[model samples]
Target: MSENRKKNSALKVILIIILVVGLAVAWIGYRAFIASSIATSEEYFYVHTDEPYESVIKRIEDEGIVKNPSYFNYVARAMDLQTGIKPGRYKLSKDLSNRRFIGNLRGGYQEAVPFRFQNLRLKENFAGALGKNFEADSTTFLNLLNNEALAEKYGFNKDNFFLMFIPNTYEIYWNTKPEEIIDRFSKEYAKFWNADRKAKAAALNMTPEEVSVLASIVKGEALHVDEMPEIAGLYINRLKRGMLLQADPTVIFANNDFTIRRVLNRHLTIDNPYNTYRYKGLPPGPIMMPSIASIDAVLNYNQHEYIYMCAKDDFSGYHNFAKTVAEHQVNARKFQQALDARNIKK
Candidate 1:
């Protein structure tokens, strides 16, 4: 009986050790599963140029894409990945291991797509267009360009600073902030305005603002690039002679509608700062987004004594230069005849 009791006691001790070991192993496995789940969860992530660690964590949490935001923050900080995450939209899974998550975040696993801008003009319009391609509010994007502080820094007044933003195709990451994009474009604009252009503008008694305004008018008026210098020359002559620019583009701008078949005599009487016909100078601002060709045309326009030009009837994509009102009237009549004959629906 004593031998049987001792054997029973030995068996009890062995069973207790096995049970403890099994519980410990199970606990470790469960912990590992939780950690892996948090790492791989389907969460939206983002990073920016100067995003703080707390903000990044909170942003991900607020997005409701993660199951455990704190876990992600802790793991990321532990692995020294607090600042390594790139700026872009990321797709994450809930079942990702911590190692895999960090690897993907820091390893540049995703190729960022690019967004572009082309021929943008109005501040609000530009903002709305950019908003369609990026993750920013349109109003905020516009207010920056219209900001007085940035304008003063860029050597332009509020009314004319918008022209400094040239309309060109710019490549940026798809998720780029509106502010960064604006900064990049503004920097490029500053580079474009060199000392030589500045000297030329000063010589013409025109500010950079006036040059850009004229360039935009020339861009919108002449369909052919070769005609730009001639158009510029005509406007420059008018400015020199104290004559009304009387540019039809200005009338179109004042009207806020560009599809006019022909400018009626009454359209010239519109009371707007942009109507060069009424205002004896250049428009208040640029009428359209001018290209580099147009800007160069204004900068290098040939000095001419002539004060008028009318479209040639030859359909040769050139204009008839007139030195007198009589000659200009004749050329204008000729152009009208050609339009009538071609049944050109303007």
Candidate 2:
């Protein structure tokens, strides 16, 4: 009887051990299955850091990027990723298992916003626009560019730090540091000024910054590329002959109005140093953001002795190049007549 009782106790202990082992295996298998399912889904997810984290997670869940907030929280905690999530724009697969999705978000590899330079008017304006998109301070951007030491380190001379930038679209990692962005742009601008361009600028007795400054002026003067060279020649000739460029754009820029149909003598009397009609030589810096065509025109300006020019008065986007003051006045009169005929005041 004692042996039978002992045998029964041993069997019962064994059974209990097997049952516990089986339950443990099942739980492990279930956890593994959940993790695997989360990793291979096709769900989409996005995060915009403009809002609070809770709101961001809510949006992520609403967009079906994650299966459940609790699952995301659990995975995030388990992987020690709770502190690694970066704030910015992010995109993820909606069908991604909670584990994979949370891991990716924590890794900060989900998305990057693109920075583009379309419809950029001025350096400050472009900086302001970029600030709006990237949550950067525009004042900081402008200050960095205007920093004399920084500008010089980036190959910009004292005379033309304001116009050293070359406008183009750029892809920046989201939430990029402001100083880093400026430094990157400065490096890219240096790259654009290749050895060949540098030599060409040297041959013209100009620095790259000066060339860009003149290019900006040419950019503001004409919208047509075919006329850039002639306009460039005109300005070059004026510089050589010690004549005031007498450019209307400079006067308009000084007055902060390019909409006037005509430039008056009083407009030329504006006390700003940018008024080429009053100030000899080019303005202190570029008045506008020049296109690549204008920059090239400055590098490849035609060798001409022409000192003056006026619009052809045909609205054909052409110019009448002049060699003397008298000829310039005649062309100006013709342009004025054309403007009068069109009832365009300038």
Candidate 3:
């Protein structure tokens, strides 16, 4: 009975030891694989190209991307996460498991940023916008824009290169090269010029780029979307008649002083090609990023005899149209008088 009692005591001790060991193993497994690895609610992190695995791990730890980075390191090694890691922008959430976090990093599960642009007036402005949203440098974008070889390769000259960027939201990898971004824009530009749009441009006896330039003028002239077609027609008439565009917006752009409320005589005399008042027909390129509506308005221009327009005297953001110079002068006088009354000196 004594020996049996001793045997039962030994068995109990062994069973207790096993139970404690199993629980410890379970706890370790949970911490290493099942527990939430991300400390924050959310985080966006970047792994640079050719970055060492040690550096990547350090970034995760230093950036507070994980609740228990040591546990992450353990699971990461177990899954061989370092073997296939690639550079990208990745998102981490508290909901992510250690395994998932490591697995995602290994498989290059990345997030694409939405790049949006519209109504940007200058190439430099667009460069800043690109720099704000991507890993690309502003200087790189500017250099590409100024490169004649690049522009020619893309069916554009340096002057008209800005027209290639049709303003809209585009999903792109954050690490996309600046040149690759230009490629994406070229593709989007092609897509925007469908057969129907090309046919319309052809019927108007203008290239797509020319239409966009005219659209920019139409955009600048009217404050209302409804007025674009009529204003476009008036400009079309001037073009057909081989008259100078004499656009106030072009003069403002050439002067590079957007604060001018009233275009004065001095502003029109700037020896710049963009000064439409000094040059015949359209400017070299768009003075602003033309909206889709403005482009379509030019394509479907209103058939009218009016070749002149001036802002209405009431400042209603509409225009008074006229065919004869005498009538235009009368409209211009009323608008000029209104400007004088408002004290909008430029």
Candidate 4:
């Protein structure tokens, strides 16, 4: 009976050893396989639209975020992440476990990218800027902007479609669609035209579009914000008197050649309706996307009698204003002599 008891005690010791070994192995496996799988230096990972699971894995691997790609693959399969892939920009941090990483992606938890633009000159440029931030391609964006049916839905046409996009920062997802961007901008445009602004437009006898058009001209003419109201007043005076605007910026725009620094008589003769020297009213559309300051400058223009302006001879980016032709001629001669001295023939 004593010998039998000794053998049973020996078996108990062996069983305890096996149990301890099993627990240790299990702990090590859990740490290696499930925990600390992500080892990235970056703060975020971007998964693009229509990206396959393999491409996602490749991107993670290329970014050197996953410590073991095969193990990560196994974990991903076990979690069934392949069947539930969501595209977006995901934030990352060091020491992220495989389970948490997959969970964030599967849950569609993403960060919104901030989008901003100002002083963009053309629709193509605006399209390109939007494409860079969102999932839509530039060609697709341009197509939507030019679509008459779509533009009409937003109360715009191909010529004035760009007016909807005010220069401001917007918080949006990286994968947002082109139509979605347009919709947001359309709402923003409506919000900008409040009752106070509409009343101001009415007081000026101008539509919002016409105000934007004149603002574009004001933007092109002035380099100083302090002078914008004065310039706007000068244009308004000309319009009130039924006089030709004779804005050199319009002539440059008519030629579609922004390189022309000197607005020669030949440039003024451009047959396009954008030429203020030849046309009687505001252009059919804005020549460039004007700033809010420029727009407000037109709305609350300074009450002035000046009808003519000449660029300062010192090239200070400020203009000389005149209430009569004689004063304008004096300013003009000063500028002309300065231009001649510099030999600016163009």
Best by TM-score: 3
lDDT agreement with native, every candidate? 0.75, 0.73, 0.89, 0.87
Better of 2 and 3 by TM-score: 3
Location of the lowest summed lDDT over 10 successive residues in candidate 1: 32-41
> Which pairs of residues collide in candidate 1?
40-93, 40-94, 40-95, 40-96, 41-93, 41-94, 42-93, 42-94
Predicted structure 3: lDDT = 0.89
Residue-level lDDT for 199 in candidate 4: 91
Query: Model 3, which residues run further than 4 Å from truth?
Result: 41-43, 313-316
Candidate whose lDDT is highest: 3
lDDT of 4 by residue, 1-346 (tens): 9999999999999999999999998875686456787677787788888899889988888888878877677778888899988999887876778778888788888888889888877778888988888887899998987898898888877777777777888899888877887898899889988888889999999988889889999999999999999999999999999999999988888898989888899898779989999999898888888888888999999998999999999999999999999999999999999999999988
- The TM-score values for the models, in the order shown, are 0.67, 0.77, 0.93, 0.89
Write model 3 residue lDDT over 1-346, tens digit each, in one string.
9999999999999999999999999999998899877886556778787889999999888878888888888898999988988878888776788898777788889889888888788889999898787787788888888888998998888888888888899999988888899999999999999999999999989999999999998988879999999999999999999999888999999999999999999888899999988899888888988988899999999999998888999999999999999999999999999999999888
Descending-TM-score candidate ranking: 3, 4, 2, 1
